[model samples]
Target: MQTEHDSTYISFSREEWASLHPSSQINLTQSEINHIQGLIGNLTNEEISKIYLPLIEYLSINMEAAKFSHHVKNQFLKKATKNPPFIIGIAGSVAVGKSTTSRILQSLLLDLPARPKVDLITTDGFLFSNNVLKAKGLSERKGFPESYNIRALIDFLSAVKSGEPCVQAPVYSHLYYDIVPGQYHQVCQPDIVIIEGINVLQTPKQVGSSIPSRVVSDFFDISIYVDADESHILKWYVERFKLLKKTAFTKPESYFKRFAELSDVEAEGVATDIWNRINKVNLEENILPTKYRADLIIEKSSNHQVDNIRVRKN
Candidate 1:
């Protein structure tokens, strides 16, 4: 069967990818692994040692290469400041484990001998406020690229790339399903940063007419796409919805609190409809189209575990 791809990438089975530069040191503890695992995730330390640890080892090499290039540029320009932090971008479909993979990488990178400080930010915070979306009649398209304040997101990255001291990113709440009012994640200078979102790799032309001079991926030193069959993602999304219906949706303040009392079949049906209508459409037209743009792609199996990996040959 054909896999996700083009001639630009070389695919590797999970075993081959794990063996590329195997590391014996499992930097993350079991507790940390548990915390890194998302609602629908079953991440284990073995996977860390087998998959992510080696992945970061590859990243570290790239990071060093970037710094060397920066150093040479600085010398020619006669300046002394070190290069800006290495920025990594992660993208994938909803419920495809992008967030969990990002967190795990952040932990592993920090625990490296350099122990460089790392910050993670998600693009959810850049989403147009619920009020704004409703006003613009985009209430049904929350996760679509048009729903985001792409300029604001680009501005945040511009500041980071410029090595700004303290840049504040708007905070987003999943429970409330909106940007938090007057709240922000203050990002200080760090050795590395990871930006996570479903649409990070999307191009402006695909997004709409409001194209920035530079797209989000321009600032990324590395980009990753978490890949899985849409069928698997549909199952995962509905399962997560049902799980949340019993948990987060139960809270009175949850934006989806109305779903809290849904019966099993009712909850599944609602979630399925949402996927068919909104998320799947976004994934097809926007998210999946950008998959090949990633420097690395982690393909997952039906069980949501990494089954293969593809790295850009260039």
Candidate 2:
């Protein structure tokens, strides 16, 4: 039988845990299980099993903990108050597999019997329109925090926290490199809402002596940071860029369509230049600085496997 680790004390090594379960037993149907198996080639069965099962268990436990805390607080106040929906923030450097992690977590959380209604939202949708960026002469700094409409993001979160029946968020297109007009994703009241982004844990910019009203982290019941060495991430970013150039960039409507026409040598150089100029700079200035704010950190090995998980003590 699986047992819950004590909240105040938890210790386990990857090797010891792997020895108990050499392979992951996927609970999904054959077809779905096959698809996942295809995605993570050669990963130990144990690693795959632990990926979702333990994750779902951990999240469920945390949600319950949040509820108990709220109950105690309400009792102390001698008044009734609605417990806000649990919000999770996921942050990582560019090309550090954050998107993949988010998708996996969403799937795991949704599969949980107790928390089947889980929603996943990405900060990409909150990014300012391309025209707006051009007008402000900030097109090159596209992924920076300033390029996003902070007020809109805050309002969306506020609505989610208030238990709104339906909230619409914009959808962004990677091929077009812009927000698709009139294409909004509607999120209903979910048991959990996962907000994944490169800078989700960043502190809110202060206006005056008064401490900044509320940083995005204020809304998060839990936060996770996917971490890896800078050099490894840079290499992954460049490789992913090359893959995109062959795939999405070939589309006529893609902003980077011209990249598809470049020779192999030229493409590598272009990918490197973009990594060094834009993505790397954003990683250094905006993303890396927020690492300490995460409640949990998943450090990736060179092979892109999660080798260590560091959880902040309460």
- 175-263 per-residue lDDT for model 2 (tens digits): 78899999998988877889999988888775456555767778999998888999888777777777777788898888999898887
**Candidate 1 residue-wise lDDT, 109-219, digit = tens:** 888898899999999999999999999999999999889998899999989888899999999999999999999999988889999999999885644555456899999
**Best-performing candidate as measured by TM-score:** 1
Alpha carbon lDDT of each predicted model: 0.91, 0.78
Candidate 2, which ten residues in sequence have the lowest lDDT sum? Answer: 36-45
List TM-scores for all candidates, in order: 0.95, 0.86
* Residue-level lDDT for 137 in candidate 2: 95
Q: Give per-residue lDDT, candidate 1, residue 115.
A: 88
lDDT at 196 for candidate 2?
A: 91
Index of the highest-lDDT prediction = 1
TM-score of 2: 0.86
